[model samples]
Target chain A: MTARRFLSDLSLTVCGLAVLVFLLLPVLVVAPMSFSDAKSLEFPPPGFSLRWYQSLFGSDIWVEAGINSLVLATISSTIALVCGTLAAYVLTRGAFRGRRLLEANFMAPMIVPAIITAVAHYIAFARLGILGTFHGLVLGHTILAVPYVVLIMQAAIRGFDIRIEQVAATLGASRLTILARVVLPNLWPSAAAAWIFAFVLSFDEVVVTLFISGAHLTIPKRMFAELIIQVNPTITAVATLLIAFNLLALAVLLLVSRRGRLFERGY
Target chain B: MTLPGSYESGPVASQTVAAAHDVAAEATAVPARRRASLRQWELFFLLLPMLLLIVLIFDLPILNAAYWSISDPKTGALTLGHFRDFLDSTAYLRIIWRTFFLSLEVTAATILLGYPLAYWATKLPPRWRIVVLGLVVTTFWVSILVRTYAWIVILGSAGLINRLLMWAGVVSRPIEFLYNEFGILVGMTNVLLPFLVLPLFAAMMRVDMRLLQVAETLGASRFRIFWQVFFPLTLPTLAASAILVFILSLGFYITPAVLGGGRVPLVANMMDLLINRFARWETAAVVSVVLMVVTLSLYAVYQWLREKNA
Candidate 1:
C-alpha cells in the first residue's frame, strides 16, 4: 500500500477504536468508581474503598427494591414463558387461520412506544383499582416481555422436530406426554432464553413503571428516583454489580446454547 | 385455508391423515377426530392465555387512554378540544418541535460518527472485529441509567473533562456541561451510537468486497469507489437505523430529563410533568397519541419506501 493509503487506514482504525472506547466508557468508569472512596463523582480518586458496596448491602430500601425486582422478574418471566412458548408452539406447529394477525397482535406491544404504554396501563390499572399492586406489575411486565419471548420461542420451535413427537405418539404416548417428554426438552434452551430475556427486561424497565408504579418500587424505579433526588456512590456500585450480573448471565447463555447443541447431537 | 407449516411437515403427517381416514372412513378416523376435537381444545387451551393477555394487558390500557382522552371532564362531550388546546398553545407546540429536532440531531450525530467506525470495524480481521463487537454489545446491553450517571461524572463542573481543561490552563473556570442541551446531546448520542453501529456493521460486513476490488481495477479513486459504489449500497441500512433511532429518541424520557437538568423539556418529559405535576392526564394522553401518530406515520413512510424500491 502507498503511504497515503496507509495513513488513511491508520486514521480510520484509530477513530474506530476511539468510538469503541466511547461505547465502553460508562461501564468502565462505573466499575472503577464503585471502588473509589469519594462521596462525589470524582475522577482519579484519592483512594479506593468499599463503603458504597457495603451501603447497598446494608440499606433496607435498596435491599427491598432488589428483592421486589427479583420477585417481579420471576413472576413476569414465568407468565411470559408459558404464554410465549405456547403461542410459539401454536404458530409453528398448529395450522390455523389468522395466524399472521395473531402473531402481529403478540408483537404490537413491543412496537407501541413505552410512554404510551405507561399512559394506557395507568388508565386501565387505575380503573381496576390495581394501580401499584403486585398483580399489576406482573401483568404489565409480562406484556412487555411476551413479544421477546415469542420471537425467541418462534425461532426455536421452527427448528423443532415434529417427527419426534409423532414417533412418541406411535409408541402410545399422549399429546401432553409427548410435549412434556419430547418437545419441551428440545425447546429448553429457548425457554431459558425466554426467561432471561423477560427477567432482564422486567428488571431494566423504568419509564412505564415510573408512570404507573405504586408505592412498591422495583430497583430501576428506585434507581431512577435516587438519581434524580441525590447523587450517590452507592448507585454506581449497584451499576457495576449489575454489569457483572449481565456478564455472568451472558456466559450462562453461551453454556446453555453449547449444551443444547451437544444434546441435539446426542439425541 | 391450509395451515402454514402443513406441507413442510412432509409425508409423515399426510400418511397419518390418509391412514386415519382409511380406518373406518369416519367414526374412528384419528386425523378427523383429532382435528375436530384436539384442534379446538388445544387452540382454546393454548392460545387463550396469550390472547387474553394481549387484550387485558396491552389493548385495554391503550383503549382506556383513548377513551379517557376523549371522555375526561376537561375534554368531555367527545370533542377534540384537548388536541386543539395543544395546537393552540405556543409552549406545547415548541416542545413538540424541539423533540422532533432533538431526535433528528441525535440520529445525525450517531450516523456521522458511526459510519466510519462501522466501516473500519468491518474491515478488521476476526479477532479485532470480535473485540470491537464485544465492546459495542456490552455497552448496548448495559442499562441507560448507568450510562447517564457516568455522563454526570464526566460532564460535572468538577468532572473529568473540566478538570483536564482547567489543569491544562485552557480555562480557569469550569464550563457548565451537565444539565443542559449539550449534556443531553452527548449522553443520548453516547447511548444510541451502538444502535446505529451494530446494524450498520452487519450490513457493511456483507457488502461485496469484490465489487470494490473491481472498481479499483477500473482505476476509480478510492474515495469515488466508496461514495459511488459502497455507500450507496448501505443507504437502506443507514435510512433504517436513522428512523429507528429517531423514533426511539422521540420517546426518550430518562436521558433528557436527567441531562437536561430540568431546563430542556422534551415532549416525553413534558408529558410526564403534565400528568404527574399538573394532573392533566387527558392532555398527556393526547400528546402520547400525537407521538404515536407521528412515529407510525414515519414507519409507514419507511415501509412504503421499501416497497416502492422493491
Candidate 2:
C-alpha cells in the first residue's frame, strides 16, 4: 500500500513538473535562440552574437513598425484609461437604471472574439472610409483596451472606502472636486496598472490590426507577415524584446496592484 | 414568429409602463428622493462621453456587421442570402466543425495536464507555490504571438526537437511538426495552459483541507479521499475553466495562423479568407454573427459555472 502511494505521488510530481517545463519551454527556447550564431534556428547555440538584434535594428520596416506600435499603444491606452475610468466610476457609484446593462456593453468587446471584432471592424471601417487610417487603428485598439481598463478601475473603485467620499460630500466638497482630490489620487496605482495592462494588450494585438491596419504596420503585424513568408532569425530578436517588455510591464503592474488583488481573474 | 415576437415584447411593454409609473411617483416624492434623482442625472452626464465612444466605435461596428449580414449589398433589402450561402457551402461547415473539434481537443488536453499541476501546487509549501505560480503568470504575460513563434523554432525541420531526435538516432529524418494540426494543438495547449492552471490552482487552494482530513480519518483511502472528497469540491471550477479554455480556443487566431501555417484553417482563419481573400464581406459578417452568438452562449454557461463555484 505504501509503495503504491509512493508511486502515485511520484507520478504526480513528475507530471506536474513536466507540465511546468512545457509551459515555460517557449520562453526558454526563444530567448536563448535569439543569440544563436547559426543561420538556422539551432538549439543550444553554437555561439552567442547580436547579429539578429543588429538586423532587427538595421531594418527600417521593423523600426517603423515598432514606433507605430508604441505610438498606437500609447494613444489608445490613454484614451481607454480616461474613458474607462470615468465610466467605471459612474457604474460603481451611481444608483441609476441600466447601469448593469451599460457595464455589460462596455465589457462586450473583451468577451467577444477578436476575429469577430476584426471582421466587424473591417466591414464597418470600409463603409466609413477609414479602413487603412491610423485613427481607425487607434479606435480599434482603444475598444479592445477599454474593457481591461473598466475591469481594473471598477475593482479599484469598489475597494475604495465610500465613506471618505461621503465625508467629503458632507463637508461641502463638490462631487467633481472630491473625485479629483480624494478618489483619483488614491486610485492612481490601480489606474497606472490598468493603463499598463491596456498598453500591453494593444501592443501585442495582432488579429484586429491585421484586418484593419491597411498601410500601417505594428510590431506583431510585421512579425506575422515575416513569419508567414519565411523563418527569419530577426523575428527571434523581436520576440525576445517583446517578452522582455511584457515582463517589465507585468512587474510594474504587480508592484502597483499588490495591495489591490485587482487581478483576481488573471485576465 | 409572431408568438415569439409578442412574447419578447410583452415584458418590454409592461416594463415601459412600470418605468413611467415609477417616474410619476418619484416626481411626487420627498426632497431627498428628488435630490437622488438629480445625482442620477449627474452620473448619467459623467457616463455619457464613454457611452458615446463605446456606441460609436464598438457597438456601431458590430451592429453594422449584423446589418451587412442580413441586408443586400446594392439594394439594401433584408435577406438571408448570406446565411443561406454559409449553410449551402460545405467548406464553411467543414471549417466550423473542425474548429469545434479542435477546440474540444485543446480544452481536454489542458484539463488533463493542468489539473495535476494545480493539485500538486496545492500540495507544495507556500514558497514553492509562489514560484510555480509566478512561472505560469510570466508565461501568461508573454505575447501570444511570441509564444506561437517559438513553436516554429522548437518544432520546425531543423528545430530543437527534430535536432535532438536526429542526434539521438531516434529517427533517421526530421519529423513534420510545423504547419499542421499537431503543431496547432501543441502551440495552442501551451498558450492556453496557464488560463486553466491559474484559476484551477486558486480553486484548489480554496477547497477545504479539513474535509480531506476527516475523510482520511474515516478510513478513506487516499485515492477515495481525493476522488470522492477533493475532486467533487473542485469540479465546478474545473468545469468552469475547461469551458473558458474551450471558448478561448474556439476564437484562437494567432496560434493557428502562425503554427498551422494556413494548413489547418479554423473559423477565424475562414473568416479572414472570406473577408480579405475572397472579398465576401457579407459572408464574413454572417460568419461573425454566428461565431458571436455561439461564443456568447457558451460564455453564459461559463459564467454560470463560475458563479456556482463561488
Candidate 3:
C-alpha cells in the first residue's frame, strides 16, 4: 500500500510539471523570437538582433494603432465604470419593482455567447451608419465591458454594512454627502478593480471590433489584418510588449487589493 | 342624579368619536413616511443611462440578429431556406461534429489537469496558495490573441520544440506540429485551463479539512479519504466548470483559426467564411442562430438539473 501511494504521488508531480511546461513554453518561445536577428521567423537563431523591436517602433501604422487602442480602451472603460457603478448602487440600495429582472439584464451580456453579440452588433451598427467609426467601437465595447464592472461592484457592495450609511443620514448628513464621503471611500477597491477589468476587456476585445471597425484600426485589428496579408516578426514584438503591460497591470491590481482581499472572492 | 339612559348614551358616543380620530391620524402618518422614502428615486434615475445603453446596444442588436436569421435576402420575404441549407449539408454537419469533438477534448484535458492542481493548491499554505492562484488567474487576463500567437511561434516548423528536439537528437526531422488539430488542442487547452482551475479551486476550498482528518482517524486510507470524502463534495463545481469550459470552447475562433491553418473548421469559422467569403449574410445568421440554440439548451439543462438537486 505504501509503495503504491508513493508511486501515485510521484506520477502526480510529473504530470504537474509537464502541464506547467506546456503553459509556459509558448510564452518562453516568444520572448526570444522577438529579439531574433533574422528577418524571417526562424528558430535557433542564426544570430541575435533587435531589428524587429526597432521596426515595431519605427512603423507609423503600429504607432497609430497602439494609440487608437489605448484611447478607445481608456474612454470606454471609464464610461463603463461610471455607468456600472450607478447601476450597482441602485441594485444594492434602492427598493423597486422588477429588480430581479434588471439584475438579470445586466448579467445577460456576460453569459450569452459573445459571438452572437458581435454578429448582432455588426448588423445593427452597419445599418445605423455608425459601423467602422471609433464611436461605434467604443459604444459597443462599453456595453460588452459594463457587465463585468457591475458584477464586481455588486460583490463589493454586498460586503458593506448599510447601517453606516443610515447612521450618517441620521447624524444630519445629506444623501449625496454620505455617498460621496462614506460610500465612495469604502467602494474604492471594487471600483478600481472594475475599472481595470473594463480596460482589459476593451483592450483585448477582437471579435466585436472586427465587426464594427471600418477604417479605424485598433492594435488587435491591425495585427489580424497583417496576419492574413503577411507573416511578420513585428507581431511577436507587439505581443511581448502586451504581455509585459498585462503583467504590470496585474501587479498593480494585486498591490492595491491586497489588503481588501478582493482576489479571494470569485466573480 | 341624572337619568340612567342619557348618561350611558353620552359615554358610548364619546368613545366612538375618539377612536375615529385616532385611525385618521395613523393613515395620514403612513403616507408621509412613504413620501419621504420616495426621495431616494435619484438612484434609479442614475441608473437610466446604463439601462438605455444596454437596451439600445445589446438588446436591439440581438433581436435584429434573430430577425435577420429568418428574413430572406433575395426574395425580400421571410423564409427558412437558410436554416434548411445549414441543416441539410453534410459538410456543415461534419464541421459541427469536429467542433464539438475538439471542444470536448479540450474541456476534458483542462479538467483532468486542472482538478489535481486545484486539489494540491488547497493543501498548500494560504499565502503560497494565493500567489499560485494569482499566477493562474493572471494568465486568464492575458489576451487570447497574444497567447495564440505565442503558440504559433513555439509550434512552427523550426520552432522551439523542434529545435530543442533536434539539438538533443530526439528526432531526425522536424515534426509538423502547427496548422493541425493537435496544435489547436494544445493551444485551446492552455487558453481554457485557467477558467477550469479557478472554479475548481473555489470548490475545493469549501471542503473542510477537518472532515478529512476525521476520515483518517477512522482508519480510511488517504486515497479512500480523497475519493469518498473530497471528490464527492467537489462534483458540483467540477460539473459547473466543465459546462463553462465546454460552452466557451464552442465559440472559440482565434486559436483554432491561427493554429488550424484552414484545415479544421469550427462553427464560428464557418460563420466568418459565410459572411466574408461568400457574402451570404442569411446563411451566417442561420449558423449563429443554431450556435445560440445549442448553447442555451445546454445551459438550461444544466440549470434544471442543479435546481432539481437543490
Top-scoring candidate (TM-score): 2
Count of steric clashes across candidates, in order? 0, 0, 1
lDDT winner between 1 and 3, please give it.
1
Off by over 4 Å in 1: A166-175, A259-267, B1-37, B74-76, B301-310
lDDT of 2 by residue, A171-217 (tens): 55666787789778878878888899999999999999999999999
B1-310 in candidate 1: lDDT tens per residue? 0011111233654565555443333333455566456656765678888999999889878877877666646436787777888889999999999988999899999998899889988888877876776677667667888888888878888788898999999999999998888899889999999778877777787688999999999999988999999999888877877887888889899999888878999998988898778978889888988888888887766556545433
Across residues A1-267, which tens digit of lDDT does each residue of candidate 3 receive? 889988888776677657666666666677788888887777756778788889998999999999999999999999999889888878988788899899888877887777778778877888899988889999999999999888877766666656555555555565567677877776786688678878888988888888778788888888877765667999988888888887777666655555425456652
**lDDT (C-alpha) at residue B306 in model 3:** 48
Collision pairs in model 3: A132-A214
Q: What is the TM-score of chain A in candidate 1?
A: 0.92
Clashing pairs in 2: none
Q: Write down the DockQ of candidate 2.
A: 0.40
* TM-score between candidate 1 and the true structure: 0.90
Worst 10 residues of 2 chain B by lDDT: B1-10
